[model samples]
Target chain A: MTNDNNDLATLALRDVAELVEEKLIKLLPKAVDLEQQVIDAMEYALLAGGKRVRPFLVMESSRICGVGESSALRVAAAVECAHTYSLIHDDLPCMDDDDMRRGQPSVHKKFDEATAVLAGDALLTLAFEILADEQTHANPRVRCELITALAKALGANGMVGGQMFDLLAENQDLDKIRITRLQRMKTGALIVFSGESGAILGMAEERRCQALRGYAHDVGLAFQIVDDLLDEEGDSDDLGKTAGKDSKAGKATFVSLAGVDAARTKAFMLTDQAIQHLDIFGDNAENLRNLAKFIINRAN
Target chain B: MTNDNNDLATLALRDVAELVEEKLIKLLPKAVDLEQQVIDAMEYALLAGGKRVRPFLVMESSRICGVGESSALRVAAAVECAHTYSLIHDDLPCMDDDDMRRGQPSVHKKFDEATAVLAGDALLTLAFEILADEQTHANPRVRCELITALAKALGANGMVGGQMFDLLAENQDLDKIRITRLQRMKTGALIVFSGESGAILGMAEERRCQALRGYAHDVGLAFQIVDDLLDEEGDSDDLGKTAGKDSKAGKATFVSLAGVDAARTKAFMLTDQAIQHLDIFGDNAENLRNLAKFIINRAN
Candidate 1:
């Protein structure tokens, strides 16, 4: 993928995210009068420096499925909400215990711990609320399908379960397969859900959805592998979050279990597999193909 | 308000809650085993005995509007999920910090804080998942409406907003109106949402829904007023949660500012107003009328 490809993916994501943000701003009730708090927390996390990878996947996958822009925007917003909630909770004292997120004070640190917890809970609930809104999409079955996909991705079988396994693996003699499963649940599940849910709305065949799910799974793993490698070699300023915390915590990471070179090689291989799977969609998925490459090569 | 009416309402609530519990047990996913922690927390808190007021409002209000049992059951479950999430979060160390919930250890105390937080997040997301499921309802619009209603009730204008105010009011002076506003937002919003959401499914008329909202608001405030009085007079075992701690914490309650008799009188007035609005439903809202009475006079 060329720089132009990454730029196009970034532009498309920014445009869709802007639309979703506008819709969210309007959909929230004015009566609460806590608009400032809601906006502050939302913009703080969303507009901060991290790449909008999940939302980008949602938009690109939907586009690949030939979905309408409006429908794609809803799914993008919903996925972002889920992603944001996880970040907030993961930063809590009992979890990752990070004080910074995306180059800013973590929600729990900026606000109070209780506020951060509530904000995450509120955002989590709001994601479903946004997706389920009648005006967001026309299909009830599709909406339901998206909800199921998201729930599974975020619930025990997805992020939280992965977090549990990661916690358990700390300082333990964890094997390659077990480590991969943990990473898959933690990050891969939501990424896969983001891709497949968009396809569900587009009336895509089950096989195509499955193939997209496979692509997402591989890319998601590759993304984490690269992240692990980056933590070892990337600049702290570039990463936004504190790098190398994984090794300090004795958490088994791709770069820890295998060498940095091995992780980098694995990332490339996974990206190739993802791109190959998108061959059936042909050039229609050029943007998604490029996005996969960008994930592997991203500096941050 | 009579003995016969109260007894009938009690029996109905117990019966419906039991049925809803049974339905939930089956609908839960077996593959996602991490759900057990959340499911146990929900069951422990849910079965610990409140009036099942919110779920009953969902069921009875839906019946009043002539919606079918299935839709009502789903909505009831969604309401319960939201309610459960609030309780779990409210019990956290940084929040109310209560050790006891429903006469037992709070989820945070029963499990760890991290598990409690995840359980709450799971339950919160699960509500929307339930609404969005195709098997839950035939109408897409209805599912969307349910999601939006529950979200609004749980978000800033409702539970979170109220909680924010509560956090601010701690060790601070608050006028009666401010206290009422806080209580209304925290507890009343969801109550109003429950009845209005049920009405939305049955009758699409905005005016009727508004009337139901009005009814819910008054009843919700009335419900809190009684709770204040009960904390001063009710038994711990009977109430099922820690009471009398609000005064100790210097928190504002209706009784703190208005006195017990005044608060009691206010509750009666609110309940009357709630009943007056139900005249729109005429004889069709007999259950609602009884429910309004039940909200004010209950010991727990």
Candidate 2:
């Protein structure tokens, strides 16, 4: 992509991030009483700030598929909620045990551990509620499709399964194949769902759905590769998280297997392949193509 | 209800319980591997015997509303999954912190705390996946409705919210109204969903739905009252849990507010009212009326 195209993509990303933030603020429970600390904690974690990459993918994919914007925005918010819930749980003392998230105290650190657990649970339940509501989609079929896709992506065979595998991978000899499978389940599943949500919402052709799936598959891996690289080289202040923790913990990562320079080259290759899968959509998919590049290039 | 009617309900409950257990066994992930300890923990926690009250409510409600047995069974299993997930999380060290459940060590005790947390998360995700699948109901409308109802019942304003209140109520003097609200959100919410699920599945008339809701409201409170009674007087051998723990912890409960005799009388009164609400269905609701009586009369 050219510099102008990059600028356009950057502007579009910012707009979508703002839109998602606005929708989420409206959707989240908001009362400032101490009695409802769980809701307060949930809102705190959700509104705390990220790149909104998943929501961007959902909205952009929906735009390319000609789906309605309002419905797509709701789905985007739901996806972000689920994503945030995962981050909260993953940072619990019993899990990855991180005290900081996005350069701020994690949910458990900000509130109590019990409140953190309940907040994560509430956010997850709210995501399903949002998708199941009739306002999200006029067609009940579409709603069920979204719920089913999300449940699968987040279930034992997907995100949870990946997390379990990751815990077990500690001090274990994980080869490239094992590590790839782990990343696919842990991180790739939701990314795939984000990409395919538009196809499901629009009831797109099988070929179009297949194209999105291919694009998501490569982009998801590339995203993980970039993440591994970032963890290795990025500063904690810039990344907004603890840096080099994976290496410190002796965990197997893409960068560990391929080295940082090789992993960077591999991420670029995957990004290029991901963009190629969007050629069928032409100019309608320009944002998605740019997103593929952005994933590999993002600083945080 | 007569002794014969009570016997008939007992037999039906046993049949439904067995069916639900069988379905859950098949539905749960199975593979005995070291790395799959999380799945094992979930299955272990789920299969531990209880009265299967929620599943029975679902099956009975569906039967009266003219829904299919197969789809209702799926919903019943899903309800149990959600219920079991709650129990697992409630028993976690950060929550209720109970070491024993159903006469066995809790999930966190049997496995590690991390495994228990992940298992609970997986089961919760699986419940939505089961409901959203086409096999649960041919109509996507029905699927969406089920998903929506379950999510509402389990979210912040429902189970999680109630839990937060319960935690806050510790060492505090909670009056009748506040305690009632807490129990309604905590336990009553899901029971209401179980009863109304049949109406949703059968697409019953608004009046019938309202009737079921009323029945659920009274029965749910009565059930909790009996629980408080059991906690005060029942034996650990029979209850499969520590008895008298509520008073020991100084947590306010129905019995704590009303005394044993008054609490027991209130339970009977609520059960009578619960039966009255089901009068619209006449003979079709015999099992439900009997179940209401059985809930108060149960030893455990």
Candidate 3:
């Protein structure tokens, strides 16, 4: 946001924010009278916008799967709430110990550690609430399916497990396999769901869902590889947070294990594979293809 | 658990735990490889094992609604997972700052804060996952209703809002009405869901659901009043966690505002009202009626 890098990705996110933000604001309860501090913190963290890439994936994926735009937007906001919750918690004093996020003070820094924790918890809870609500879908079965996928993506074997793995990696010597697994679990599972959501909503065939998931998996890894690249090479102003945090924390990343050149090549290859996975959708997937390229080329 | 008071409530909990814990353990993925620490912490907190009151509420409510015991157990485990997650978070240094729970080290005390945080998160996610799974119910509609209720109960306006109120109370003088509202939001919402879950599962009449919810509301209040009383008069050895924490932290509670004798009378009145609400169920509500009476009589 501070810098105008990754024009297409930025544009895609702007489009998503336009489609998703108003509804997200409505979904979040406004603090009226007493005990409003944590509510304030929840709103603050959510409003601190990143590129909204995950929401974009939900939108584009749904577009390909023929889900209604309004329904897709609901899922988009839900996933973003989940993503934002993870970021808030990850920025805590005990986790990554970051003081800033998305070019602003982290939730814990803005409020206290306790408020940040509760806000994150509330946001995560809101995600499921949105999906479970009748507004998300006409059929309760479809809604239940979505809730299950999102819950699994966020649970122990998914993001939380990946976080645990990442933390332990700081003290242990992690190889490429373990690091890649960590990256996939930490970030890939949710991306897979984001892309797969539209398919699920539309009740698309298993073949199509798998195709979207495949694209998401490759793109997710490419996105993380590029993140490692940016964290290694970019500035604090450009990244909106500290650079070289992976190295500083002694955490093993794709770029850390493999040098910058190899990591860049891997990212590019993954991007290509990701685009190939979108071929089944033909012309409709042009935006998705562009998204993959934009992901690797993003400077910050 | 150690006090052996409230025989009916304790016996009901023991029955529910026996029905629920095995399924809960199976649903939780065991860590056979890397990133086992957080998983360990999650199990530790869950296995620390209180009297399992919430799960019992779900089981008994479902039984009266004619739901199968096996099916009811799933919902019971799901609610207990949620309850355990809340306790783990509430014990963090930034929250209640308790080092022990149920005569054992708190999750954050046994494991590091970061692990405790992730474990709590994973458990919460797992609750939704359990609810949404096909194994929980044959009809997704029932599952979705359960999930929506649970999510609402756990979200900002429910448990989280109540927690925020309690935290703010440390700095402000809260009146009886405000404290009652706070208690409802923080603890009452989940208990209502726990009682209402069975009706939703069994497709009971709205009247029945409301009656169960009415009973739950009074019982939840009585339960809290007894908790405050225990905090004021019971020792740490009996309560398993620190006693006198409410006064020590300078937080306002029912007992603090109403005094010991008045609070005791109010709890008994609430317990009586709770039992009366279950009159429609007749002999089938025996355990439920017993649970209401036990709430005010529990020593710890």
Best by DockQ: 3
Give the Å shift of residue B267 in candidate 3.
0.4
Which pairs of residues collide in model 1? Answer: none
Report the C-alpha displacement of residue A10, candidate 2, in angstroms. Answer: 3.4
What's the i-RMS for candidate 2 in angstroms? Answer: 2.0
Higher-scoring candidate on TM-score, 1 or 3: 3
Q: Please give the TM-score that candidate 3 achieves against the real structure.
A: 0.97
lDDT of 2 by residue, A4-50 (tens): 76777788889998999999988886432233888888889998888
Q: Which tens-of-lDDT digit does each residue in B1-300 have in candidate 1?
A: 688888877888888888678766665544333335655665565555556788888888788777888878887887887798899889899889989887788888987787788767777777777777766567776766677777877876678878877876777777787887788778988998888877877865777787788888888888888888888887677677776878778888888888888888889989999999888888888888887888776733
Candidate 3 residue runs with Cα over 4 Å from true position: A1-9, B1-9
Give model 1's docking category: acceptable
Name the weakest run of 10 consecutive residues (lDDT summed) in model 1 chain A: A27-36
Can you give the lDDT of residue B81 in candidate 1?
A: 76
Q: What's the C-alpha lDDT at position A270 in model 1?
A: 95
Question: Which digits, one per residue and each the tens of the lDDT, describe model 2 over residues B103-218?
Answer: 99999999888888888898999899999988988999999999989998898888888888787788897889889988988899999999999999999999999999999999
Q: How good is the docking of model 2, by CAPRI class?
A: medium
For candidate 3, write residues A131-174 as lDDT tens digits.
99889999999999999899888888899999988887885788
TM-score of candidate 3's A chain against the true A chain: 0.96
